[model samples]
Target: MIAAEQVRAFRGMTRAGTRSVLIYRGDLFTGAVTLVIQVVLAIAVWRIVYSGRPPVNGVDGTTAVAYAAIAVCLQSALLPWQFSSLPMRIRTGQIATDLTRPLGLMWQALGQNLGVLLARLPLGAIGLAAAGLLGALLLPPGLSALLLAVIATVAGAMIAMLCNLIVSMVAFWTLEISGPLIVYRFGSSFLSGSLIPLWFMPDWLRASIEWLPFQAQVYTPVSIYLGQTRGAEAVALVGVQLLWLVVLTLLLQAVWARARHKVVVQGG
Candidate 1:
């Protein structure tokens, strides 16, 4: 039961979030530079791995390189290093401010994230273009594949946002979340196949990741775009993304319910 007033409030918060991020041109510049560096390094590593070598396990050098470029770019866009603000607010006794808002605390946070996401979208596009210029990116096999990839990418971003939101709530109890945030960021990156495609993983490792939400984050859409996954399997992967979306949403609600009453402020 969403009211129109809340929708308007969310929109206003989103705009504020976007303006806050966009006003910092230096941050955008730094992010773009970092994304470029990452793509370059990823391309270099894969090229060296496959230099003078035939396709390993049905994946050629070109395909592998392309995967790395796209994966890195998407990872940069979708998983930009953002810490949970909840921890900082709790530590500074600012959680009280958010608690007084007319909009629910979680909804306000989500609105802010949605705005940040809008701002970051162009960064991802720029990375893709850079990959194209470097000869590391490839178009999807066909229009249908491209469309499906788009859908999966959106779902992936939402899945990722929900996962982060849930994790960020841990600050409510711990009061300091830096350690957990760092661990979760890198752990999710690897598990999400944003660094290495699951195609390259051992069978057992792949089997385990298949059931986790991380795979749906970066791997599924990119793999579909590469056409390495097609037909029913591709559809199945997107289905899994939707399933994870629902599951993570429920899990986030459960976490937030507990966190609301557990706020721990420091230096009060």
Candidate 2:
């Protein structure tokens, strides 16, 4: 059982993080617009691809549109960059002060990112609504699927946040994290099936990527949304997400232990 004080602290951090996101509402709108544009382009391409084919690999143009719509709508949360502050904190010596705080850095970071994600919810809803209006999106097949998709998405978001936190922790070892960040973003985009559904990938490649954590970030939830995963299969996919959540949580603890000890304040 969680202690009351811990719950309060988590709520407090979440509120602080939410306020930070609220402070940047303008940027959030800009991101939403960009997603709208990307969704349109993606829809056009899929339509053309399906113009001459019948549900190529079991995904039709209409289904593809719905997939892209929800995928992009939730992309903000699925691929949140709010925790990028850790590297900046390290560079400016803010992490030293952070280290002195009573709360653990991991919880603090998680709370802030959770707040940021909450702030993005309204914009994401608006995007989805607009997409639905334009026929670029479709409702989930049933209430049960929708509920399962949501659960999977929440788990996926946790996985994403933890992965980013792990990446940001690299700041403890090096001043430059650009290379690692780029590689991670690229890999996550491709492997997570945000750029292309894993269903369409070669069987061997898809099977390999499915075993990795990135797939839990975008593919699983989107697959659930598309109704490609249902019943026991849906449960298994969510199970995989939970498994990664545990594995990543443990990995983060190990990484933070070593990273905290090696922290070097660079500037005043």
Candidate 3:
């Protein structure tokens, strides 16, 4: 339902975000190397944990390793180190100009994050390729699952971006969010099932994580890819993601309203 002009403006913003990442191709290379190393280590850890043992709670070593690799790659692309640039803009007062733009500030930021995701995908693919080369990666069981995983992955990326925006908007109040940001980064890495697949966790832990939006970010997509969650279950998981998308979108809007108000009050 977006207008043509709005779509065009969004495309330009997305390209600007893409260009920002590509401008430092060297960083992408370095990031790829780092991603590869991290994925390799993750693969090793999972393999070692399941070494010569039976599948833990219906999760085989291959599935675990594949999940780790895919999760790491998703973490890299979907969850950037600096998830949002809003905090910096807040410090520089550029957020004021951003608010006055034709496009919504949140929409504009989402476009930029999407652009970064596009640019970083190559790095993720490299890490995936390395994992495959090392014989630790596995593709989805079928095209249907693969398609659903793609859908789930897109939803997950949006959820993560919204969460990042929520964090970034904290700067509007405190003007310093490093501590919270670091906590959120690690917390998300663990809770999103990127550090380890949800299957590897205890039943109680898995149940608890299912209630959180983080699992929809990495766990759901990778689990779908591994065919761990199939058919109706897979669809339901995507449904859960859509649910979080709605919840988080509303939350972000509420936060953005307050942030905008704070900016206006202080500027006056």
Candidate 1, residues 1-268, lDDT tens digits: the string is 5598888989987887677678999999999888888888899999999999999989999999999999888777666677235567767888788888789888887777778788888888888888888899877899999999999999998888888888878877787787888898899999999888998999999999998999998999999999999989999999999999899888988887777656542323
Considering every candidate listed, which one attains the maximal lDDT?
Answer: 3
Shift of residue 200 alpha carbon in model 2, Å: 0.1
lDDT of 3 by residue, 1-268 (tens): 4588899989998998899899987887889889989988988888898899998788888888888888898899888887667788888888878888889988898888788889888998999899998898887899999999999999998899888888888999999899999999999999999887787688899899889999999999999989999999999999999999999989999998888899888892
Best by TM-score: 3
- Which residue pairs clash in candidate 2? none
Ranking according to lDDT, highest score first? 3, 1, 2
Please estimate how well model 2 matches the true structure, expressed as its whole-model Cα lDDT.
0.81
Model 3 clash tally? 0
Error of 2 at 88 (Å): 1.3
Model 1 / residue 25 / CA error / Å? 1.5
Clashing pairs in 1: none
